[model samples]
Target chain A: MASWAPTVLASDTLIDANAVDYLIVGLYFAVVLGIGLMARRQVSDSVDFFLSGRSLPAWVTGLAFIAANLGAVEIMGMSASGAEFGLPTVHYFWVGAIPAMLFLGVVMMPFYYGSKVRSVPEFMYRRFGTGAHLVNSISFAVAQLLIAGINLYLLGTIIQALLGWPLLVALLVAAVVVLSYITLGGLSAAIYNEVLQFFVIVAALLPLTLIGLDRVGGWGGLTDKITEAAGDNPETAPAAQQLNSWPGNALSGFDSDLLSVVGIVFGLGFVLSFGYWTTNFVEVQRAMATDSISSARKTPIIGAFPKMFVPFITILPGMIAAVLVSEIADTKAGEQVAGGTGGTVTYNDSLLYLMRDLLPNGLLGVAIAGLLAAFMAGMAANISAFNTVFSYDLWQRYAVKDRDDDYYLKIGRLATVGATVIAVGTAYLATNFSNIMDYLQTLFGFFNAPLFATFILGMFWKRMTATAGWVGLVSGTLSAVAVAFLSEDAFGSLSLGVIPVGGQGAAFLAAGAAFVVDIVLSVVVSLVTRPKPVEELKGLVYSETPREDLVDADEASYPWYRRTLPLAGVALAMVVVLNVLF
Target chain B: MPTAPARATQRRHRAGALDIRNIIGGLLAAYGVILTLMGLLGDPETDKTGGVNANLWAGLAMLVVGLVFVAWAVLRPTYVPDGGAEDPSAD
Candidate 1:
């Protein structure tokens, strides 16, 4: 087994910071602390701390909804992917993200917000039973810890490489900052900072892209340079189809047979996307913080608009790095350049290289601040989500039943600290994985894909019994594990006659298979068992629920075209245009 | 009649309505001003991106937008609902 180690940078390669850079970074930290302190006064009870008292507006919740997902891994991994895979990587944003976000806003929000469930696991308890709730709560808690650790690990590694600070020191500073704010102000502070971080990320990335584009000439210039570089080194040439978003022949476009159009559509676009964006509590918590049902329903739609354009800043820089950072024969053993020949390109260091090579001192600080903001936002999001599930779903339900609001609130704060500590420990474990993002997606397949299956059956099919919910969830998760173990690539154990899709593609397929099994088992078991009465299933199930129960009165006043559907239409149109253009 | 405890609770609720937009706007404006100043007055000889000082331009733009958000927050303060939890099943 590979041991955990931090990615280090040579002292000479570190960007020299000036007075202005330090000032910018200092100001950024001060503002974040100020926001946290300000939000501290708002938490008077458990609801206030855990759910922001459900008082945010559409725009605030909307931006934060997307921001929570924009972590260190996202910034670094997506850029690395852009350099490695080219335009095809944009699928993670567009097809893999947009539709699902829209679905959450339009279809699923009514159930979550209308029912007024404090968290996703609470909803599982109401719809399924204690068994399903426990399964989800435990799984979600574990996933959040792992994800938090991954964010911390990536942040520490990046900061160490950029500032030449000890990895442990960097991790400590991040944990202290994140823990202080989250413990003091709770989810409100986390959400407020996430919105702020969104703007900072844009500010940091857009400039690098513009400057790089100017130097390269234009988009055409970037492509030409890449083509030239690939031409010189026949061994490193990207597939002919990599440059285009969607080639005329799907099979010919991808470097591997694993990236089939069918897999991208069914596996990634439907199962993984819906499972994550719709059911995952980390994203849904933002939407649930909205003041009214209408705002809650609009939150993900609002997020989707900005989310559609994020690739320009996030992915474009990597593409530029691919062209500009040339292959150099480095004498140092520890130093790995972005696009080096013979020596491996430290693909994870792509974003750091862009900031160091492109920006001046003052601008460099803003960029570094932006990177810090993303890391903090990501860590805080997981901690908040973890605490909520631990306190409300697990502790309240199992350990300390019938506790007062104050008791629960106290537990929530303590849980935040405890989760943060565990997460810090998990961060050390992250170094074992080769690619953090791929590992994260595989974990999602194990838990969320099956969870979404149960959710779909519960919400849409009223006949789904509580027994079926537990059985489906367990069976679906098992099927996913089976597929992973059976796949020749993932475990290299057994054959299921399934063609070898690469890591990401295989994960997507496993999720798809799990979804199918969940739906089938749920339907069969539910039919055989007794079903709940229509009255009992009122707000929980769609068929029996009244239209007014699902929608806000204010939203009903608007015409059909004036609502979120138009936004979805516009987003879909843009996706089509991008696919064609690329 | 409204009791002393009820009035105190209302006061706490009112105080809790800290407009998050105000915080966002203030922080952006602060950072924007600093970056803008550096872009305008900092070392000109070390022209990294040829001649265009992106820090100054982006900073000014962010400053204007942040100020607009601040102005909006002041002009139309967000209303705080009563301090109470809803019946989860009421809908």
Candidate 2:
């Protein structure tokens, strides 16, 4: 488990599940399929299929909002990060997630919900014109397919690990479960299943956390063990760095403490988090499925409450695995331990090892089912979002025009099937990389960062022109790609190593570069070209839209806790306390 | 045309006919029952989870949460209006 060693799943079969476990997993599948069929009854039109007819309550959408994100990355990747980096990994939540989420709910959702666009790219079309809309649709659609494939591959890998089934069979099993629901009921099915999955995931992880903490004698005992390990191994990071959350050099891969803090705050927190949360249609779609704009505004704020505490279950377990399990401890100390998916163990196996060490059969079944639910929630989000963009933005706008609503609804269902099949092919494409997180971050940097820049600049500065939109997006994406090629290990051995940063730091640098270059180009081009008339920018531009239109008039009549601003304020205060305590 | 009690019943049925609460509540309750039974009859597996009866405790907690969800839905069913498109802000 050397730090620089390749990260791949390639060992012996890891779990020995029994009949009870299989029964629990089967029950979960039945419920999932049942919900899909029930949701199908609600889908009578294209809007129903694509956006749940915009009728779900706030709490449901809120839970689904976070559930859609609690994917393989949030579970396996974060746990692996926890085992590797210790307490510093909490910054990814407190610093990187909550603030941006609040901004999305408070500032951005109204524009999206008010404009009544079916997809994020459609919003782009209304704001910038055909050029940016075309670029955004293609990139977003491709990104979803690639991401869905990653989720599908991880789901398949877990199945193979559990049951010793063939890879292709596991992959098909994973794909079909997700495909069936999304095709049957569309966004409504995905959202409802996500809500169920969110609860199942908590039920599974909370037990693992409590048991692990009890075994390790709670937080104090865990810290002492980490300190002991740090003292024993001089090659690893100091115990102080591991125990504390500030400066996060171990996680950020920066030599200086200041650079790490700045990188985390600006790069990870601002550019990457804001870009992904605000502009990425996968997350936005959940918020967009609310019954009202007020509910939409409340969605991410409600999700933020659970989002902040997730580290307790995900990261703490990884910390426990590092100390409690011998193989993980040895691997952390740079020993070549034998056992895992691959021939050698990696930090990515931390959650599985901990589960195996602690959970008995009945609980083990629930945990396995939870893992499946998480992966399915993630893949369903991607497929649902992909289908919407493909049907409304791509096919309707360009491929075929003025088609009947029923025809587009049929097209949406077909797109779901097509995307899932395409995702199976992309699943193999994802296997080329050693670390899935690195691959995912690079993709986010290339696609999301420049798009955020274009969005923020265009939204505030009405002078930003249509030409500026596409040109800025194109140049920004190219710059990020160029930066990735120049950085160390961003493209594996293909990187030129001129920039020196590797892994997540390279991703940060790329996103930052993309944002700056895009802003500069957009400003330059906007100054030269004519802007869209002020009348046309009513809901699209910030200053032009009325303040009353951005908020719910009935909000003041509700109790303090139910209002958006008060809820957001409470969430903000809680996260600050968590940051200070951790 | 209709009695007051009849009108209330009609309104109740009109709102959230396919309540998500029913689904979530039903599934969690089912899982809770299974785990609780396994805890009572099967081996406690104390050796594995630091001498704690994890399944029994977790199952009971889940049972309570599930019941609360069901009770909440029964007490306060979601009130979606008849017209699905209720975008008041839209011009």
Which candidate has the top score in DockQ?
Answer: 2
Candidate 1, residues A464-506, lDDT tens digits: the string is 9988988898899899887877664443334463655555666
Stretches of candidate 1 above 4 Å error?
A: A1-13, A234-239, A247-259, A327-345, A488-499, A558-562, B1-17, B44-47, B81-91
lDDT of 2 at A375: 93
Q: B1-91, model 2: which lDDT tens digit per residue?
A: 1121122233345454357776677667777887888788888888889899988988888888878877777787777766454544321
TM-score each candidate: 0.90, 0.95
Query: lDDT values of the candidates?
Result: 0.76, 0.86
Clashing pairs counted in every model: 0, 6
Error of 2 at A24 (Å): 1.0
Error of 2 at A532 (Å): 0.5
Report how far residue A409 has shifted in candidate 2, in Å: 0.9
- The candidate that wins on TM-score is 2
What digit string (tens of lDDT, one per residue) describes model 1 on residues B1-91? 1121122233344434456666666666776787788778876323456567877887897789778877786677656655543424322
